[model samples]
Target: VASWAMISNFIDVVKEGRGTFSIQGLGDPSGRGRMISFVKAPARGGDKEAKKPAIIAGTKTDLRRLSMGKAEAILKTLGVPAEEIKLLTRWNRINLIQRLSTAAAADGSKLGDRYGGFA
Candidate 1:
């Protein structure tokens, strides 16, 4: 089912050269979760912009919590340098927040006035 598909994708990503990955939720408070690892793909190709790494954000309560460990192991097995593996614990939700703000603004109504917050 969906699990199988995700596993397949993970394998494919590992086989590919130089990709960034982010794992989330090893441990955190506030019930907000945290990022566990940041895998930086090796430098390849001439295009600097193309070198942008991939991100795999995970949360503590996520169903696939074990994925973080699995991903790290696989990357290591593939001979990815140790320096490429970094542990991080931040969730980047700016995109979502910006989208919500944009939508609210587009409605031509002030958020505080419409939602009854501090003016």
Candidate 2:
């Protein structure tokens, strides 16, 4: 439940349009970065939301694995620009993850300062 709350708080921050959860400098040789992203992806909703805890607690997925459907849902959720959404979604670029993950992680005040971004 703790992990769920932390992730949910992060999601709430992104939903508020306060900040973004970047992925540029987030990845690494270890896997904490992956944990953050792993948790972030499931937080998007639908069937994914239910398995958020297991996803975070269990195995880790590829750092660069994300579907087109997820891209559209994220762009729409985070309020990304309309024209750019198509291009970004088509390419499934890293910037989209950067903007999205940070958006998910930021919590307005401190998290906003540390992880908040839309670029």
Candidate 3:
């Protein structure tokens, strides 16, 4: 979807634009990965069933410089629901990102329990 591409492009831009600097001033809230990524559950018993969906890391940091208008336009093109985009483009989208990451973690955790953990 366009939304996924938007994220991917943002990542590429960050990596291409000398994004090699990180600071501890962000503290424990910035632990581990600097960006969000998805990981799927392992296959069920000899690959009979399809792999589970992936979850995104909530604590990701987007280093790309995106304006509100660009973000709105991008989300509109991506077909994201109006309400969801409203949250996503709001003053920083902290609430939505937090909720998304938490949901992803919870979903991944459930999948892990069901599938006996990821590789």
- Ranking the candidates on lDDT from highest down gives 2, 3, 1
Q: After superposition, how far is residue 15 of candidate 2 from its true place, in Å?
A: 63
Best by lDDT: 2
Q: All candidates' TM-scores? A: 0.18, 0.32, 0.24
- Superposed model 1: Cα runs more than 4 Å off: 1-66, 87-119
lDDT of 3 by residue, 39-68 (tens): 211234346777754433321334134456
Candidate 2 TM-score over all chains jointly: 0.32
- Which candidate order results from sorting by TM-score in descending order? 2, 3, 1
Kindly state the number of residue pairs that clash in model 1.
4
Q: lDDT by residue for model 1 over 1-119, one digit each (tens)?
A: 25574455456557664354434332222235554233333345446665534333421222223244543443344344545533421121222222343455466566523322111
Question: What's the CA error at residue 79 for candidate 3, in Å?
Answer: 9.3
Q: Per-residue lDDT tens digits of candidate 2, residues 1-119?
A: 26685577577557665444444233122445553431222233345444443342232533245577665665666667767777763556556656565556664554335334432
The Cα error of candidate 3 at residue 14, in Å, is 50
